[model samples]
Target chain A: MTRTVPTSPPMRRSTVADQIRELILSRGLRPGDALPTESVLCETLGVSRSSVREAVRTLATLDIVEVRHGHGTFVGQMSLDPMVQALVFRGVLSPGDNLRALREVVEVRMALDLAVAEKVVAAAAGETHPELRALVDEMLTHADHGETFLDADRHFHTMLLESIDNQLAGQLVGAFWDIHTAVLPRLGLALPEDLRQTSKAHGDMLAAAEGGDVAAYREAVIKHYEPLQRALDHAN
Target chain B: MTRTVPTSPPMRRSTVADQIRELILSRGLRPGDALPTESVLCETLGVSRSSVREAVRTLATLDIVEVRHGHGTFVGQMSLDPMVQALVFRGVLSPGDNLRALREVVEVRMALDLAVAEKVVAAAAGETHPELRALVDEMLTHADHGETFLDADRHFHTMLLESIDNQLAGQLVGAFWDIHTAVLPRLGLALPEDLRQTSKAHGDMLAAAEGGDVAAYREAVIKHYEPLQRALDHAN
Candidate 1:
């Protein structure tokens, strides 16, 4: 059975998708809102079920709606991964060249990084997750490896994000990593002094994590990002 | 060929995708770096070609890898639109009121919006694009219908992005619109008063477009968003 098929003409699926998305977005439709059943949709939109189905499928990919087996379709609250993936991909096309845009990106990254750090501290205070400690070991292993260390470094941050347990925030931050890579090499190797400071600061961050000191944890993260930004500026 | 695949060990596609992505990200492989052919990748990772293809496809979607029609895949440069889409989708999935996250989203939106406006000032200077003017007309249609002017509002900004001819930036900004729908009712009525103010501001923006006065254009956009932000706060 179809839901409210939009009364639009050919290419009805796109039209239906657009209208339904428009309503859900404008009216703030939530889960369980009965989308016009197939018949109602057909009557309303004056379209075929196939068109409705296609529209519904597109929405499904966006996680805008869920099609149940036998039961009626429901609204979907999907993960941000797909959308995040698209943004990062597009950002890749431009390569972040505008000095103003780059600066803005960095500034925003700082806020997100700080927020993640704050969360990490809160999580640490509540419990000692061995997984977090294990990252330190991995970091050490990467420190020994020449080229492979970057992955280790990324892993440390990715792990830190996981500890925060905000997947949406994590995904947003992940996009930064991609853009960062596009421009990072121009920034040059971390100054030994900067790396030293980073390591020491990381130690402090670990402590904050252990102690569950939200403020300190957040500060530590900001501290880490600051040098990276400086290094990036130097490269650019 | 799959590089990160572990055939005998049954390595997961995600594992391979992650490793390859990191490699590209770390500048181990630069943009235009010819990614290893599939067979080589399979041999290196001891995995099947199918696994390699899957991994590459994921990276392609992320814009981390691009496969030519006949040529092999190469590392993708930064792309913003897809990443933003993915991020926004993830944000929608996150639990909580999302009001705070919306603030961050708005922050990014403001940056992108202003950037596009600024770019339009550059690109549309003395250039004639009836389409943008047409968007203004479309806004009127929406206003006449007593329908929400959000789509037209979005189209206007999108027109600006397109004016600057930045597809990725446009996509990032579009994703923001999609996510911001959650806060719409609280955002503002887009009532006659708001629409008039918006339409007037848009007219001024067109003047800025003709004059290439970026600062003036940005100010005009600020005028539009400020009330919307306040409405959001009031609604929440």
Candidate 2:
């Protein structure tokens, strides 16, 4: 004997997801808080078990909801992981000779970093950032070995944004950085040949920040990304 | 008689999603390119049919894949819709006395706008944006009636970003604006009472752009967001 199942349309799944989101909000559920079980949600939403399961699966991708096997569902951390994934996929999907997606990511990253230069300088006023200095030193060491310091470079940018006191900005910096790093390799694009120039740019940024020269810091930020921009242009 | 079904673990679902993404990348599928059918995907990935369905649902949420009813799944538009949804949900989940999520959105928007201000001014040099002026006029007309011009305000910012020639920045401006507009009403936050002041800030922005004065334009952008900032602070 064969059993037949009803197919839930995509629109219905989306509506069910929205309803679950509304349920979470109405109940004032925080991240990590347990949500109603699958059967419970099915009954509450007046939808099929398959619909609830599909909706939960969808929300989980956005980090809006978390599902733990055997344990049940809960609120999610709501991180920007989904954005990074989508961005990286976009970069990967761009046809050869069409690096617009990656270029757009770089432009936004530069814009945000340049825009926050003054704020970062102000936040670092009369304060020493040993952590940032350490990252720069690590980059320089890697440069001396004629190798790229991807980890140090990522950490340096993340640490720089920390001074701005904007969590969203910090997360964006991280997200864009992840996209750039993930996409560049897949495109067969090499890092700038002049690792020293890149390393020195980080040093210049630190010096300008410590000296509280916003103009110099902004210039350094531009100088830092210039090499990567050239590589992208060359690829295009 | 009762039928038994096996439950797929969350990790398995995630792995299947990754494999599907890999398949798309390997096949060089562009947005709207249809994927193999569910049975084909299950056979190819060697995963259970239910696992493939759940994985597709997850990928659909991130917009990495699109599933059309009665049609095959295809590569998605890969737009920033998922980001906007995640951000709006974040803002909505913030309880009273905590407007941090919304404030962070505003700060990022302001930073991005300010960062691109000089570019916008340069791009507008020797050129007039009739569309932008029309938006400002629409905003002013709304102000005269003691009402808010949300659509005009949104379009104005969007048109301003277009001058910078950065697609990602434009999308982000739109995304954050959506979040702000969607979240503020839910929080029971009211727009600033001085509609005239808010409307005039747009005028100043336009005037500054037309004159190619970056400083003035930056100031106008800051002024435009100040009232909203004040509202958020008051809410906090």
What is the Å distance of residue A132 in model 1 from its true position? 22
Give the alpha carbon lDDT tens digit for every residue of A44-87 in model 1.
77778877776665555445677775787777755444444443
Question: Tens digits of per-residue lDDT for model 2 on A12-70?
Answer: 25688889988999999999999998889989999999888777877888888888888
Task: Give the Cα error of residue B44 in candidate 2, in Å.
Answer: 4.4
Model 2 DockQ class: acceptable
Query: What's the TM-score of each model vs. the native?
Result: 0.47, 0.88
Q: What tens-digit string does per-residue lDDT give for candidate 1 at B1-236?
A: 11221111122235777556655545556567888888988887777887787677656654567788589989875354333433343344332464555566666676666656656687889776677677777666765665556656666776677655445556566667655654332333232345556665766777787787888888887776775667556545
Clashing pairs in 2: none
Which lDDT tens digits does candidate 2 get at residues B172-223? 8877887778788878889877788889999999899889999999999999
Best by TM-score: 2
Query: Which CAPRI level is candidate 1?
Result: incorrect
- Runs in model 1 deviating more than 4 A are A1-178, A181-183, A186-236, B1-15, B18-45, B53-57, B60-98, B115-119, B126-128, B149-152, B163-170, B182-196, B230-234
